[model samples]
Target chain A: SQELEQSPQSLIVQEGKNLTINCTSSKTLYGLYWYKQKYGEGLIFLMMLQKGGEEKSHEKITAKLDEKKQQSSLHITASQPSHAGIYLCGAGRGGGADGLTFGKGTHLIIQP
Target chain B: GAGVSQSPSNKVTEKGKDVELRCDPISGHTALYWYRQSLGQGLEFLIYFQGNSAPDKSGLPSDRFSAERTGGSVSTLTIQRTQQEDSAVYLCASSLWAQGEQYFGPGTRLTVT
Candidate 1:
């Protein structure tokens, strides 16, 4: 079974600061997905990275998959209060039908 | 298009009782999954249903947990003789394919006393 370990169980940053959250997998990643969740709400898909060395960005958030596909990072540039939430990384192996293995998630708080 | 939806946004049960959580996947989705999230913890994969194929139950925490998909659309997860530890949010997700991006429902918060 694949396991994902996320760094910095939680993060607090001042508004307009930059932050990064990392997700490391125990097995080779066939696909990596980033999602944001407001407390008590369903997760919202952020980005998905498949190919090794692939990077995808939406708005102020960017995600990159390592060449080895064993690790990925989510970077938020000029973060704002809206970016405050739990950032979760989900890793998948093989086909799309397989269930993903997820990390514990990083709780991000933006200070005004 | 409507995304995945779960019934009874919140549930409170007593230990030794049984509970059922329902999930309605998006129309035409070929894959559905169930996951549990303990307070302040990450998601734990519970089971998966893909089309009419046998579901993957390897992630089920114990035999007391069981699930069935009806007509390949709605899924129900039943926890028999629930324990206090069973308190958590049960989330349901669906995707066009198993490996594609999954859409998640708001989830049912189950609190066992």
Candidate 2:
């Protein structure tokens, strides 16, 4: 079974400060996806990275996949209260047909 | 275009009762997936359906849990003799094909007392 280990299970940061969350996969990641979730709500897609050493950014959120494709990182620059939520990194094993293995998630709390 | 949708946003049932949750995928989407999310936990893949291929049920926890997709569009997950451990948010997602981004539904919050 594939596993994704996320770092800093929970984080609290002051508004305007930057934060980074990492997800390390036990297997080579065929595809890496980032999502955000508010309490009791469905996850909102953030970004997806496939190629090794590839990086993608949307608004203040940026995600990167290393050359090894075994790890991915999500970074938030100049975070705001709206950025506070649970961030999840999902790793696809092979193709879109395969189920994604998800990390436990990083709980981000942004203080105003 | 509308996103995936699930019915009965919230459900509360007693232990030993059977519960059924429904999911309606976006029109034209050929793949649908069901997942379970425990309180403060990651997603647990329950089942998946892609076009006409045999459903990948490897993620189903046990025989008590089963799911079926009708005409490759809507899906229903049935839990027989539900236990307290079955309490979780059931999420549904759909994608245009097997290897692409998936849109998700609000999810059905099932609480077994």
Candidate 3:
């Protein structure tokens, strides 16, 4: 079984500041996904990274997969209150039918 | 187009009772998944259903947990003789294909008291 460890289990940042959340996997990642969840709600898909050294950005958020494929990071630029939530990283096996292995998630608190 | 949808947004049942959670995937999606998220914890994989193949129940916590997908569209997860540990949010997700990005539903919050 693969395990994912996320750093800084909880973080408090000022609005408009930058912050990064890291996810390290115990095995090589075939597919890495980032999702955001509001308190007591379902997850919202953020981005997916497959290949090593892959980086994808949407608006103020960017996600990168390291060349080793065992580590990934989510960076937020000029964060807002909307970015305050739980960010989870999930890893999937190469096989199409396998379920994802998720990290404990990082709780982000954006102070206005 | 609608994403995944789940029934009984919130359910409260006795500890020894059985409960069923229903999930309706997006139209034309061939892959559906069930995950459990307990309070102060991460999401745990429960099962996976792709097309017509047998479901992957490898992630089920125990024999008391079982799920079935009917007509390759709607899925129902049944927990028998639920315990307090069974309290959590059951989320349903669907992807166009097995390896595609998954879209999640609002989830069913089950409280076993």
| Candidates in order, interface RMSD in Å | 1.0, 1.1, 1.0
Q: Candidate 1 on A1-51: residue-level lDDT in tens?
A: 778999899999999999999999988788899989999998898999999
Candidate 2: segments with Cα more than 4 A from true spot: A93-97
Cα lDDT tens digits, model 3, A1-112, are 8789998899999999999999999987888999999998899999999899999999999999994758999999999999999999998844454878889999999999
C-alpha-based local distance difference test score of model 1 = 0.92
Question: How closely does chain A match the true chain A in each prediction, as TM-score?
Answer: 0.94, 0.94, 0.95
Model 3 chain B: lowest-lDDT 10 consecutive positions? B37-46
Position B69, candidate 3: lDDT: 96
Against the true structure, candidate 1 reaches a TM-score of 0.95
Tens-place lDDT digits, model 1, residues B62-104:
9999999999999999999999999999999999987889999
| Candidate 2 residue lDDT tens string, A1-112 | 7789999999999999999999998877878989999988999989989899999999999999984858999999999999999999987755444777788999999998
Order by DockQ, highest first: 1, 3, 2
Looking at candidate 1 chain A, the ten consecutive residues that score lowest on lDDT are A91-100
Pairs clashing in candidate 1? A96-B98, A96-B99, A97-B98, A97-B99
- Identify the leading candidate in terms of lDDT: 3
RMSD of each: 1.7, 1.5, 1.3
Clashing pairs in 2: A96-B98, A96-B99
Off-target runs (Cα >4 Å) in candidate 1 are: A93-97
Docking class of predicted structure 1: high
